[model samples]
Target chain A: MELPQKYSEQELVWLLKQRNEQAYSYLYDHYSGALFSIILSIVKEEELATDVLQEVFIKIWRQISLYDTTKGRLYTWMLNVARNTSIDAIRSKGVKNSRQNQELTENVYEQAGSAEMKTDAIGLRKLVHTLKDEWKILIELSYFEGYTQDEMAKMLNIPLGTVKTRLRSGLAALSKIIKP
Target chain B: MNTQEYIESGIIETYVLGMTDAIESAELEQYCREYPDIKLAVTAFEATLEQHALLNPINPPSTIKVQLFESLKDEFVHPVFMSAPTKQSAKVFDIKPFLKYIAAASIILLVISGAMNLYLYTKLSNSSAQYQAILVEKTSLQANNQLIQAKALDLFNSMQMMTDPNMLKVSMPGMPGKEKNYATIFWDTKSKDVYILPNKLPQPTLGKQYQLWAMVDGKAVDAGMIGDCAGLCKMKNIPSATMFAVTLEKKGGSSIPTITEMYLAGKVS
Candidate 1:
């Protein structure tokens, strides 16, 4: 669906605060695709990703007043919400058990590769493939997986400083690919 | 710590990725405000990351949006459903006769007020529509008044110029073929300004206009085109002129007057 040109980002936010349904619909139509992909990346299950997406949007609507423009762009704040909510869904007991059972039957890397393939043949997949495994893993963990530096350090059996450096190098490589 | 080194430390990247803890993120935010370069770096990093994230879009099922909006509609209509109330035993209290009378009276009052509200609302809407119509009429009248005021100001200025002692009024009687056509030139000799009050010139045919000329030293210099011949039109000024004339010319006035088309001519004394 074509996004409405009726309201700008600030105006849309103001309308959303006033609980305007059309503004909410516009926000959903414009941002839901990327937000859904982010959620799917972390949860790794379509059903759970859908549930988490619904919850994320509800949270966005409910807590919209808390969003401050000085902090960042609205999309960036929504991205954070999606990432955190997806992480929370994965960490929940029911989802954790299901994810662990699935992990036992399939190789994690293979699953990730398949999920990457499931995405449309956009340039992002090609760009992601160009990164070395270490950089890709760091990006996936911090960006898609919503892992903190300390958690990533423990998860990867690396030091906290190493985790930060790897994340920096990963983003630098990604940035170069994005622009160049 | 060197700010450049601090930037190169990957803290901004981590911040963009949302990997930094609360305290570390706060410190980075402070540093970004303190250093312009750091802030720029952070903004660039955030933009790059945001673009990268957006590029991998996967559209959600279309039905989800409909279902979501439907749920939202329910919440809007019955907000009490949002928070589930715990079940408790119902308490029973007997109604007193005086309280019953108060309730009955309040219901009757509510009906009366509701009727009054409906009546007032209809009256208000009717009055507001009439007010809007009046406002539109007022605007139209104001526009017409401005046009009349402008014309009056022009006429007043022309009268003042006509009565000036330094002004010389020359009457150009019609030439032989056009005996009924006449035009008047009000020349301010001191200021070297010329104006024409076209009294009897017929409307020019399509693709034609009346051009006024100042005849100086036997040469007819192009004065100006009288676009609409009915008004007091200001024509071109010449330092000194022996005669003034009017001739029919093409849509745009020519450099030299068409002498054969001359309708009126008068010599200056």
Candidate 2:
């Protein structure tokens, strides 16, 4: 049977688990650049970063079955793989020259699962740009931090209901902007 | 309480964001099982969030995609190895590392190499040293043989001279401590050449060697020292003499033989 053209994140994951090359190709062509930037930023060595990038995809290929869409997006899962791999590479290469500016350097991407997102992926920055600040923050925290709304609420000092309300509205608004 | 009201209230967003307290997520899960609409709203909220992240996903360079594609292709193609039909096919294939064999082989190789080198070095040195010693021995043996041949010819020629009219022949009697030793003397009086038969003696201790003295009226005159030749025995020269005596003495022989120490005597006629 021909693979479906319109695949949800879960649907594409299922196809990848079943060893679908078309789905893998689509994911790569669409998302590799954003992942590359994350990897490059974390691992300064270009060649080593490239190796880690290759490993990230290989792991994605072999371990796609482990991804649970109920827990997070495929991009979030993939980005975590890349980030962890790069950090591991940094340790393995014994990189001691990194600046000590830990907190100051944390952009949305510095969040473990944050850069794993596709905001700039497939040019989603344009769509995400149309979103208000609250949506961006919600997206940055939830998807990036791997935070539950409870965690987000605690972190932002907002009520749980407010965190929930903001996330739902932010997502719904994103749908209209991107899909519309 | 109404499921539709709950859906409209956007409780699904809290579920997707995991912002709701544990009891709330459990309640939503219960609702999802009870009504499909609640599940639909939940998936809808999750889908938009996922899609948004997907749109902004961190894509690595093209190489990652290529590597990913290869793995995907492997799953698609599932190529089999040539020799190994199944990795689990054989007992050999199933076997873990044979470190024992590797260790044994390496050890044996190292030992054999070490021993062989040691043996070769010893053998080479032994052969070279033996060859050098043999060369030295052969050279000395050749020189000794040549000296003996020349002495034999001299003894023969000197005997012929003794029969000549101008030469005198004398026999020396072994006397006193030299009772076992006797010698013949050929004195070429005209030429003042004296050849003694068997000019040989054993080694002496410190300050001692045999001295040959020419006797004139029983007083000794110096001839030369003797009995310490390191080379082979041969006939040797002496001066023409009225009489001959040998005595043991201090090294280089005293200016004259100490008469009390005379070991042998001969009268030349």
Candidate 3:
């Protein structure tokens, strides 16, 4: 039976390790929206994004034991997985041809709320909007596109040091607003 | 850079965002473990990223969740990779041949188990029968022992009676035709009790019994009948009897002595 109540992160992790079906349902119910948003931001299309999301969940199930609680929160680790899997899907040969015409930078600054998704992150959206386009693009490229510092530096025709600085300042500004 | 400068350098941010390469991520993790402030900053950025991700919610189509869960159900029985339907076709092999072998092995095991059960049941019944026979034999032996014990006690009492000074043993000789048959009478003078031992009496014909008679005063008094007695038979009490005799009569004794039928005669001293 699906639990009606919320589980603490530790409780959820314990249930997940035991491979509890209810925990899997709870996990899907609780985090799929956020994860789907991240996946869609990368893959851009709902059908391909849906496939990427499913692959992300299967990876999470198979690699749940590898989750190191000492490093980060469950959502943070899952965000990483979702971003990586979506990037892999688009990078694969099948997606590259169909998606060649669309520029990656176009969707980099695209607001999730502007799409069909509900605007629950209006507060965070305003805070992100206040950030300079240069700083915002760096965070989006690395966070959503799963680009490394070197890759972002080369793509933007900038030094690797500038890419690292912008990403740091962008996260610092967002962290202040979100936590404040 | 030092740990504080390192914390401020945005490396932890890249690490939390999954943008760091393997070398950069591993080095940052080592620093995070070594320094609590670096660790705290890492956790804070990770939390910030989580909150940001949660804020940007886009629900996937409802069908994917159902399909994902349905695919996961197969994982419990055998490990299944993601989207295996396409990959599995190349690896499909037939298992129909092994089914008959499995069925045959199962049937053989069933037969062996049934036969063992029947054999054990027969052995148990045989043991039970043997146990019952031993019990019956024990009871019969116990009954025979009790009978022998009673006989020994009787013989011991008879010995005591013969040795008693107040007892007078009277010898009875068989009549003219039955000269070989003889008997004895043990008469206790003090108790006035009469007992007879038909020591060598022949088995009488059907419907006839050998009986004892005591002559008291001038009249013959009827003692008691002796019927197939192997030991001392207590006859009727006689007071000052001068003679004792036995004769074959009917199954029960006759009221008067049949002189022609007399088999033994004795004079008491």
Who is ahead in DockQ, 2 or 3? 3
After superposing candidate 1, which stretches have Cα over 4 Å from the reference? Answer: A1-6, A93-129, B1-9, B52-56, B74-269
Give interface RMSD, every candidate, in order. 8.3, 20.9, 14.8
Report residue B171 deviation for candidate 3 (angstroms).
Answer: 99
Off-target runs (Cα >4 Å) in candidate 2 are A1-56, A67-99, A102-136, A145-155, B13-26, B44-60, B69-269
Q: Give the per-residue lDDT digits (tens) of candidate 1, residues A72-103.
A: 67887898888889878876744566576884
Which pairs in model 3 have colliding backbones?
Answer: none
lDDT of 3 by residue, A34-132 (tens): 888877766777788899999999999989999998778999888888878887886683356537746643653243223323323332344555778
Judged by DockQ relative to the true structure, which candidate is superior, 1 or 3?
3
Give the per-residue lDDT digits (tens) of candidate 1, residues B79-185: 21223333345355554446878989877877897798789879977987787788677777877875775576467457667877788999999999899999899
> For model 2 chain A, where is the 10-residue window of minimal lDDT?
A107-116
Ranking by DockQ: 3, 1, 2
Q: Estimate each model's TM-score.
A: 0.50, 0.36, 0.49
**Candidate 3 vs. true structure, TM-score:** 0.49
On the 0 to 100 scale, the lDDT of residue B138 in model 2 is 75
Any runs in candidate 3 off by more than 4 Å, and if so which? Answer: A1-4, A93-95, A98-130, B1-4, B76-269
What's the residue-level lDDT of A67 in candidate 2?
85
State the displacement of the C-alpha of residue B248, model 1, in Å, after optimal TM-score superposition: 43
Clashes found in each candidate (C-alpha, N, C closer than 3 A): 0, 22, 0
lDDT at position A99, candidate 3: 72
